[model samples]
Target: MMAGRGTSRRQLLKLTGAAAVASAMPFSAGSAVAGERRHGLSVFGDLKYSADFTHFDYANPDAPKGGKFIFRAPSWGFNQNIQTFNSFNSFILKGDAPPRMELCFDTLMVRALDEPDAMYGLLAESVEIEDDGSTYIFNLRPEARFHDGSKVTAQDVAFSLILLKAEGHPQVRLPLKELLDTEVLDEYRVAVRFTGNHTRQLPLLVAGLPIFSKRYYTAYDFKQSTLTPPLSSGGYKVGKHAVGRYVEYHKVSDYWAKDLPVLVGQSNFEVIRIEFFRESQIAFEAFKKGNITYHEEFSSKTWATEYNFPAVEDGRVILKEFPDDRPSGAQGWFFNTRLEKFSDPRVRRAIGYAFDFEWANKSLFYGLYKRSQSFFQNSVLMAEGQPPADELALLEPFRGRVPDEVFGEAYLQPVSDESGFDRTLLRQASQLLREAGYTRDGSILVGPDGQPLEFEFLSNSKGFERITLPYIKNLERLGIKANFRLVDPAQYQSRLNDFDFDVTSRRFAINPTLANNDRDLWVSHAGEVKGGNNLAGIKDPVVDALVDKALNAITREDMNVAARALDRVLRSGHYWVPQWYKPVHSVALWDMFGYSNEPPHYDFPVESLWWFDQDKAQKIGKGG
Candidate 1:
């Protein structure tokens, strides 16, 4: 199970934006009253910068910010930790914090990455909406301070949304369980309240959370985990760090919404840093010894055999690619299904016919990935071939509660024949594990309570033990027993926030607009909520009412037909073996910096949109 906080929702609202909002909703309640007051917001259309737009046309704001950008954190967010960390209180999951700690606070809105679901305000300078959408209010920005210049009030945004919904971190308290209360209506206004069974993307996920500092967590303990650096206000803070080998952040020369228009040219690195490496070939040999300076790559056999090095023969490393226009989301191998030997969907489609992914993409991924067939992959809300009549009118009331091959077709995976082990797809994966009661008891596979089918894959990266030891030798030729384990990045996020394990490997970026972090990935009470992103425990109530009918649709073609009928009932619940995605991003960097143009087709957040080039950092001597 390989991972990196390839995570989203930290999955820390990764790259902090999911383009779009306002498909006509703006302040209303009962027969819809209350209107005016907005700066920006989008659900999927109508809002590509207006309301006195100053910055963001993919932010350049006259580029050239400062120096030191650094890299290696290809992704991370809330409960962060890319490979090492020990709390600076990343909004509490108790310890192992680090990765871009939402760049030290500030959030009553911020997100526009060239709009797809816009969001404008910074420390709220506007916002109104009311009841029918379950109230909101915001206002703030009386010079909103906070990295100790104090005053960021509305009683510190109603004490950081009432202590992150009473002690945050289940990736900030599971979509703030429909957040029902915050109020402080004075010191520069506030209000919030929700629970009208929230989720029309809960007011830009409560305007991108984070605020805090109600007098520095009223003298500590936002559910413990501390290394002290609490109070901040944005555009970076929390300088020198080392616990897991690198951290920084710095910037903020008087941050306070640094020229907000959804933060002008964005956190332009006056030292961003990050680094962390616990493996991915020791962070690609510290980006081939340049000690990391914006890598990204996520290995396709070390980007088709070790990027040639010697800084790519003198150009001092460039490699690039970029194009990732968002939504390559769900990378796979999930299956924890809150165990009972993975409660049969024909034993998770007979363990996805022992995964060959075309002989692991031609002998370990150098054909450079493609396989991931939609948890909304490369988007248009991904559920292709069949079911079209507005996704069969949202799957005609869950037609006999799901899986008639999720209304035929639309669940592909299982092509194999590159024969890493395909004996007729392992005899149709051992006759669907002997019609889901499993057998071969003479050698090992047992189950049906006679116990032997064994588990454990867990991982914190032994780079997927050469891709899980050839899919545990095709599940030991179907006699089962698996293995792998690996552990370490703090017990692999404390055993994926204690759902413990029976298989893992994650990727989850999933953004293109269906926010409220798609209820931490296909809800069912956020798969029993302890530090979410629903790592396949799932639960289902018709995949929780087609993910609340695609997070309360309202057009974007009815949220892509309730997200293609909730991605054909989560790819007909084989709950993932999926994996492989590319659309572009590979990166490599260190030829200094400078971007301000491409990227931002809904985020490529290269250390908050690149910069610092001092003449390409003095011709790659990596200048100041």
Candidate 2:
């Protein structure tokens, strides 16, 4: 019943969930002046670790790493797909790239998962910001080198940013719209200039972008989808890979930044491998037979009933739950508002009434999930109860254009009686359709243009058929012709990119400090972009303005106020049929991996954080 989750490291920089009150002040000019060298950049306030720190507190410098870890990708970000891949050029919008492709490339700085939004220098040693806040000078580490041993220079850094803005995927290109230019100051230093009107977090966004070797791309076409791995400068290098079957990333023994404070205990596997299965059942079977070493169980039914295998009995397998402290961002069936049939808010609201989340949680989900009510579900950024005085004051400008409910109480989804069929909610749905100018034409709900109100739910996995089919059945009672159309992985992604579907589902991750690029999900222009995240085709001026206001807030308190206001407006739109969420990470793993036991509050990058345990491996009879 769940959808693809994003595991992109960039996902962390852009994620927004619960905001933590900063103990320190927001960014100030005292340490930000042009020649002062600070080791890290926090969007707000001071760095948690001093410049002289050795490693991130969450990482284990003493953790051992020398085993091959193969698992199915639970989530991915950007143009990455967990099922299949057709390109090595993950930055572009043309093809499907493998999850974890970002592992092969290093950014100027890397964000810490433990913090809300603090990034430490990786390729760059330290950054100096101009008083105007539009200019940033990054002092690169001289020791940083590409996998091929070429020095990572300022020209490459400048080239990478400019190239991404011009031709990268829309997600990568979204925040770069503020870039004025990137200038090469020296062999190991670069200057990036942004438009004066850019958001405060835009500078950090620029620094987190992946740096490419100018010499390598100069010889290859950066826009084309190819199987040949591009030249990168990250901790791991692309190893053996089958086109769409699997990919292996080998740890670089001589990686220049291996001893850097930011990466001391991360990327622990000697070889990290990802296995692709077009079907979930097949993927689970592979995990049961030991082809996959780690599995994040998404199905509550599977977790409840399917763990009595011989391995589990013998203690060779361990079932664990990791606490998800961050906000579970938006997850639901988003309507394509580009089409005239779905353009009306009333009609969209009517469709949402047909989904009985309580029945689904009992009959299908085993009562392990909660009905998702807000786009910022489980976060303080979510709007709840009534609009508070602060939020109402900020939202006062858009009074006429937005619904009155937004000013009254934050909209909550209608509750069903858990009877699988709620006649009262269905009657309300019928009334909404009639008000929106839809008429019942003897078993078919016809729209204003006299066309039947029919839309197909596009899907790639058949696992959701049970859930979607029942929803479709409910829609049928309302005289709405709905269908669940399953397509292949590549075609599903293609249809989504082109905005060709009527309805589709997705789960977005939000961190305390939101990703500046998340603006794509609500901005007016991104809705028209060929491959952007505005899947519901949201192009409202209020949403666009609210996105800017939220991202531009300098402090956590201000950000939460703005975000809550934005949430109220989005919920009122009925852009998505809100789904369900669980606050725990249900995972099953082989008894050979070791971690800090307590995962970070903001992120869960198990591949990088957990290491191979030799003693544990021997105990489980999985010794290499």
Candidate 3:
């Protein structure tokens, strides 16, 4: 997770997991009747909202739509070191782009935040799948139009798929490779065919992709990184942007799908402005001064001690925490196993023992967080205690290949007393390092070639410095030269893309309903791909096999079993020094916004569904 509003790039990629599982079931013969179509689709269940249904159950269908709704960027709470963006092209692999660029484009289908794995039609009015589940046809609504008032044709849909597969980010291109071909049946209808052995989720993933305008790109270069905003069809268009300072979006008053069932009572703001700051402290100051209207705080120290400004004291600003029902995904110090020093599992496990999470949670975090024990924390997908019969069965074939402990008990992080120095854990870590070919000369641990056992802990966030400083002290106790290096956001991103770090912090978001996107995080091929999200540089064959089983799982029970197996193996490998997570979102804003009483089950789609309260805005003298 990145730190402030809207979906980050990591969140967008993780959301595809639901689509992957949704496509697991093959369509039946009766479902393929001629002219048959449905308004909504789900992976392994019936649609939550029927075709004749109005707006989603959680939506305020009659909510007034006016006033400005300002928020900040890099929505993840702790890692808020993002500075400036140079490109308007978010889908490509070139340059850093502004957050929330997806707001400008609409997908064929829009996900209902309230549902676990359901998508309703947006551009397409109805969709039909072949009996074999290999082919899907979407009937686009004739009312759909681009920002330029040009009709969104089936050709545009087909071209978007082809273009994204060829030139989009690796996360976009890898899954799209399963798409055999796409055909424009007519001006308003398109068919997508899947290759053999494709996961059921591929079709829904394809449908939920950001649909670009074929005509717009035809007149411009899609591969280059530029500041020129492309034409979009979503509820908002690019209003004003100052390269890296700020970007503003103006609501499309005559938006094509404003009244559609999936879009009803949403996109309430007339203007949505995103302001960027290089420092998290400065952004917080701006929020306190009313320059930024909405902010979701991530730092525990800030959340615990801050919010004492006059606005908060006088009840002008509202501070609230919303409960989240989804998995508390993994965030930790990821080891780059591509390096020879980190290749051994023993070395990774030894390094993991050096971090003192208990002290950090108590002293640094103000006791507001729980230790993240699983990749899928706070979710049922987590493997608990010992490996179950099913997980054991899955690991049976790779007995000698994997850690023997994986078969007996689930992996647990080393716990320590609140005191930063734990001699017991340090001794244990030293023993593990010794077994991995490191010998201590006096206080320094040396590798097989007489090189010092050292690695750089790379980060961009100044906020993380406090947390890493304490951990670095523990690493030093083990005779490990752990150096913390802070770089600019652009340089940090480039280093991550090129896998140029020995250790780095990353938060891996996981969906309750898993998807093939997990492969991009764990598979061997993904680790080899440049710009991929395999931050740990994992490339184990057994892990790859488990990922296949999880993605191809035909039933919920089977999916859980496979996911647990994968989690167990991953934990056993000790690829990350697990961090802590809070199950609720800590948010603070001016009391000028109104939202549904119920938060979405999976995500906090605050900007999309929350409306500007005209009365409240007027009271604050910031009326739109």
Candidate 4:
């Protein structure tokens, strides 16, 4: 799903370290406890919330709850123009599911958004990790129950892990590979043992897996795509849904964890409705017509030119900008390295040089975007200037395996004079392509086999065409036949899953507390997986090793060093033509909602914390 803030499950398991001793330990076969049970778990630091803590610091416990909250569904996965969802199961790779389906299920552990990497008990009351971090034991809350009133047992947790690992989507299954086995000690306690080679974040990652009702799936196929909503344990459940038009989740009045410290001042809406549209313009029209209550604008052109409607002018609709502290991860036109045309790094770099970000930012984006330079852009993990001593030490082993530029200085994107057409960069790009066994014959660039160099730029968003048209012009100038093909969401998704595209735009949202997710996107094994996030089909051993180093890093400094090393290698690969990102979240909503002043650093938990204001709702009426 492009590994963004709302999509990537691994991002939720941001881990920091913690230590505690365990008592009343029970062993099952090869499992034995080596430490005390703790109320919460972190990677290498103390828990942000104490054992006696009531609620997260950002939550407003006394906030009023209850009216309906309606908003336009945010884009999910790589293709943003998802007009329809044929299935309710978001865990699998079969169909385009509705956005925020994770809202229905409860995980064993819930992360504290304010902290960098701290998660407290949710479905599970407490967690115990072995001293060596190989084994993690979770004590399920006896009172935890699914929507149908079925008890959430340790067996359910075990079954969920097994099911997800075996049949869930590549994003869901890939991260669980380190989990050796899950042992259900009793109705309430479950022990998850990991392979010795696993990373330190494995425990926290496993703990954050969404627990499904084992009995519910027994009546339905876990692998097949279906519209039937499964039973849920969270505060909301699938209420009423039209197969393509819209899906509404109604809050469970008798939710089991309503008063839980982790859940207090959250899930405030009585009903949360997500409506779909075939185009962003259609969605914007719906918002203007009051069919949609809230909108998070993505296109900078729209944000600047649009929004002059009567409602906005009358003060009924409020436009606000929120600060985002999370990493503005890499978003770009990713090349499919599996194809022979893109096999050479020089060819990829030459193609990247064709994208004029400076021109696009001014002409297309209304100068509202920043040129992305790193995989972990806008974060401390980003590699700056040259390689530091620690990062160089990490990169020294594979000197010849990586680009020579990696050792000298940080990789930078080709900059232009903001003229849309830069002759200097074009000349450099032409030189690079010529060096990579491509020669200009008449008007076409012919490869070593005398075949013309041509490729298709696939996209689902029509809005992207404005950006791609300019880039395509430059590619054409270099004798590269590049055409933009806008397809339906389903076809686009299928093509991406099968690696059938020559080039496409994708965003890999970097987690502040980086973990094993790097492997899922850049490692050798993931490139071979059909639906893995390695969109560029990266299979470099150096990248694989750097990902491992980052995952197992013991301290924040070590993690940054490993991450920066990995970033330098990836940037050097030129697997993608870098794009742009806005540091602030552009949000416009009707005045009928109330929310906490402080937003979470990692994610925007809009539906979870924002509640309906009855007085404002009455004044604004149902349709703004």
Candidate 5:
């Protein structure tokens, strides 16, 4: 469930001039406008929303559809045909791809109208849940096909599931594990049956799984599919590749589903290309030098002051910012429960008290981040204020799981410095440390072992490292010796898999379904021994029992009860020292592209209106 990518925070300052001209945003179109004329536009939206999004309307007005688009990602590799262990960028491509990927691929179901609820058919002609929600039947569009002439069959669907389940990323397998059976009724029909009662959000599981050719894959070694992508059935086919540098995809001129409602308003570009950059800073330089189409800003200083391009002033490089309620993907510190120092629930809650998020956001991120209180941010499910009648029905069961005070107003004792570090918070942290059997001397916490109760915090990104160091001072005051250690991607992965680190920072995306999360990250079974996503190495019988209740809830009421019960237990365990999340994605791109005035609730789709305007590209390059 954990993930990472790059973007800058200070986008408002860059967009101050452009917001002056836009007005009266329109509602998203219900379907794509076929036979639309081509007009070149280029766009950039953040990755979270892009995962399952394939419709062009979500991106922009479909236009200028005859040339190749070169997308630049910071990806390094890919997982075979499975969804697991692919490059970071490939991870997003599972359900959703970039502008090009969205244009190229389609899904059977998609998120409904920005609601974190259920899904609607995109490629599947119809889907019916039957037999008390234990069975699902999908009828695909009769004309769906890969770039080759072979017709898509129910066998392909079955093969995709078996292959993905066998080899895809662990997160990809979480939702489908309960899939007891999948039957190819006919060439155009498939039936999926779960182990028990199902969530309405079940179809969201099909977001990025394009049917693979069983014939082609059977002829080659499946494990090596990443290096040699099997003939795809999506919008674009592999055109060229320079290995680790870049990969190019050419649009299938006669793609069978091009005119389908699922693809409307998206896929304006005829070809898609992505150049991989080893360093993000180097990628930014490429964008400035016209080597890439856009740059997503995540740093406060860069957003406020970096876009000094003359094109920006002349409306050539337009920066766009919007307020939002969408989750920015929770990014913060996570503790390894496998480490004995943090085994006590009180210790984890005490650490949460030490984080000065308000100050961190204001001073470090220019107020671009919001403090997070729940795993699900900004959503109705988040446990906020006092537990309401509805919430209490769910939370009451796990009363002792979390602190009773957390259920009360005085739950998390406020740190002395609400905005920044305060000596008072330091003293409070020391007090908690003392209660936990640690003696503080000066700034070092001495444990029973006669050594400082400290461990190394590892991160791969410089940006995260910047935000992490501030808390070390607070830990020092509490007698805990905290060290900031930056590691490479390879070493980070090795350490995480080995459960070698005491703590680290990570963010996981939630797709409205709490069940998938339970299987992937929370269940005691997911801990290290299972080689699952139980990154925190926590194991508890109560949590395991709750996960079972959650998975088998047969009614809506039962589901909610299960959801809240599981949520309370997980939060109480304090597996992750949950941190703040940003609501809106701040994007800056050249003004050649046109998007709806309304901000996308889930993720901004850029395949619709964005096209490569050669004139604009040239003009901007000339500093015109």
Candidate 6:
């Protein structure tokens, strides 16, 4: 019988004192700024929070005051690669926004108010998807042009696809991947014809691709464009870029999309500037020094201890948690099966058993995160208990390849059930190590190679240093010589591109519908040498077939079936060690900004609403 702790069970029993506990908690914001509070806004009255929600509400925040907002971003301050550069222009890969929002471009289809699950046109007039979903026609709004005053035509849309595919976006051939052809029907009308039943998710893909000026690219050099202030159709235009120091975006006085419904409540700042820091510790110091106004915490220790800086005592810093439903995605050691050691299935499963999640979470994270079970987080189609009839229908085709247990149990099952870490799990882990032809001495697994089973654990973030090192210590106890290798950003990109790591941690995400996901993560066709997304190097026939089914699936029923099949193949392979997930967004900002109580969409709207509270905010930073 399993002896691991049941967090869900404990959570239910512990809910009794939750409200009283929250009421008894001391106020985090130290002192309110003394001055005339416009609208008498209460700093703690009603605030919206989220892990990934980008939308800002207009009602509470009021009209966005035109002011400069500076932040520290990982992408803007460092040297970006070709993929990162092209990603700004790439249509299907639009969600690649960094912690500090990218300055070069913007999305065209913001989430709609009436249809929270769907997106409304931003740059385009209206997008028409055929009843069969096999064909899509887009009609661009007239007079919409780049900053250079060149009208964005259907040809530009067609070129964006062709160029992105040639350049190698993981989502290069996304919604259009299944399309037979992308045709320019007229000056404003562009039509896409699918090879099979089209997915409703295609519109979201098309809406996301940044609409670049074709003529501008043809006249100016592609590589030289970034050096110059590139022309844009979004709310802001590049004002200055020091490359590796800071990049600034100035809101256009007369922006083209300002009146669009999608632009109603978002991008209120008059200027947005991002500073780059080589080290997170330096960045935090800068935050304390008031150089940046916002920072997201990834380490539990930092969340608990680091905020005690003088800024928190001075009422400038604020820590907030928002509800999140977005998938947690995996952040674990991803084995590149293309490598010989991981080619064997038994070795991979043995590794899954080796990492102790419960122990690491309690010891290192202060018990903040829940161990993730599947690729999807808390969502139904992601493979929950007993594989519902909907999921089983999808899993049927690849029946034997997937573990029978996944259909009836969690995709990731612990060795124990004690509600937390247990020594028995480690004992069972050791036995599995023995089965994999290894023996542990104090903390190292010696394999048949007569050498210890050692592997390099590559990571890119400093916060991960705290969350992951504890697990590495546990691996040491299991006799696995896992070494931590923290590489700089440039080196990390080079390694990921070359597929040169023993194991690396990262996350993958999808838009709402879960469509086009298979092509990006699983399909062999996406693994081309030039630039494919088969990061795992997965090429199994069972996975390939399931991917095809999911791609061609029209009805929700068929899509679920195909997804289940793909999920089975991914889980059976044990390519990843599980990690933690939270349904809420964790954002920290200076208390200068205000927001609505209701979520703009599912959480916070990124593109549509949210703004700076000028009067109250200015007073908060008055003395400091």
lDDT of 2 at 64: 89
Q: In model 1, how large is the Cα lDDT of residue 124? A: 85
Instruction: Return the top candidate by TM-score.
Output: 2
| Cα lDDT, model 6, residue 460 | 65
Per-residue alpha-carbon lDDT of candidate 2 for residues 1-624, written as tens digits (9 for 90 to 100): 566575343522352122222211234554376667778888765678888989999999998878988998887877788889888888887889888888889998988778877889998899888745777899999998999999999999999999999988888887788889988888888999887767767788888888999999999999899989889999898899998899999999999999999999888899999999899889999999989999998887788889889999988999999998888878899999999998999999999999999999999998999989987899889888888899998788889989998998889999999987799999999999999999998999988899999999988888888899889999999999999999998898899899999999877776677666778888889899988888999988888777777877777788899999999999999999989888989989999999877898877888988999989999988887
- Report every candidate's CA lDDT: 0.77, 0.85, 0.80, 0.80, 0.55, 0.55
**What is candidate 6's lDDT per residue for 1-624, written digit by digit as tens?**
000111010000001132223322322222122221111111121223222333334333246657666665322111233112322222222222122223345444544432324455655665554424445567777777776667778888776655544442444443355445678989987775565433444445555556667777678654322344556666677676665667677787767777654455667777676667666667678777878776655556566667888778877787787665544454456787787667766677766765667666666666677877676556544655566676666566556766676566556647444333356766777777687777665555677666777788787665566656666666666767777898876677567756788888765543334555435566665554323445677777667666656544444456556566566567877877766766555556777666654543333442224566677577786322
**Could you tell me the lDDT of residue 204 within candidate 6?**
52
What's the TM-score of each model vs. the native? 0.35, 0.96, 0.95, 0.94, 0.80, 0.80
- Which is superior by TM-score, 3 or 5? 3
Which scores higher on lDDT, 4 or 5? 4
Which parts of model 5 are misplaced by more than 4 Å?
Answer: 1-62, 67-106, 112-118, 197-200, 203-208, 410-420, 441-443, 513-519, 529-531, 540-570, 607-609, 613-624
Error of 1 at 287 (Å): 15
User: Candidate 3: worst 10 consecutive residues by lDDT?
Assistant: 1-10
**lDDT by residue for model 5 over 1-624, one digit each (tens)?**
112332111100001111111111111122112222111100110112332445534444445566445445422212211111232223221321222333334556544334433344555766654554455677777787777788777787778667766665455555566567789989888877666533333433543354567887788544442444456677776667665566667778888766654455555776666766545556667766656665556566567677887666777767877555554544557788877788877677667666677677667777666566565567544444555575565455556755565455323325345546776766666677678777766666776556778777887666666667777766665666678888765556557656678888866554343445445566665675332457787687656655555544444455455555555556666676666665555667765444566745654444434566666566656322
lDDT score, candidate 1: 0.77
| Alpha-carbon deviation at 592 in model 5, angstroms | 2.1
The sequence of per-residue lDDT tens digits that candidate 1 reaches over residues 1-624 is 224436654213620011123322433232223555877666543677778878877778877788888777777766777878888887778788877788888788877766666777888887877655577787888998887787888988887877887888776677777687888878898888886756567678778888887777788768998776887888788889888888888998987678776667767778887878788788888778888877777778887788987879788887878787777788788888888888788888887889888888889886777888877888888988888787887687668878787777798888888879989988898898989887896668897888888887887788778988898889889889788888788878878888788888888777677877666777677788777878888888776767666766666678778788888888887887887787887778888788844787877777776777788778877775
Give the clashing pairs for model 3: 3-76, 20-201, 22-43, 23-200
**Model 3, 288-361: lDDT tens per residue?**
99999998888888888988989999888989988977787778889999998898889888888878888888
| Candidate 6 Cα RMSD after full superposition onto the native fold (Å) | 12.6
As for TM-score, the candidate ahead, 2 or 6, is 2
Winner on lDDT between 1 and 3 is 3
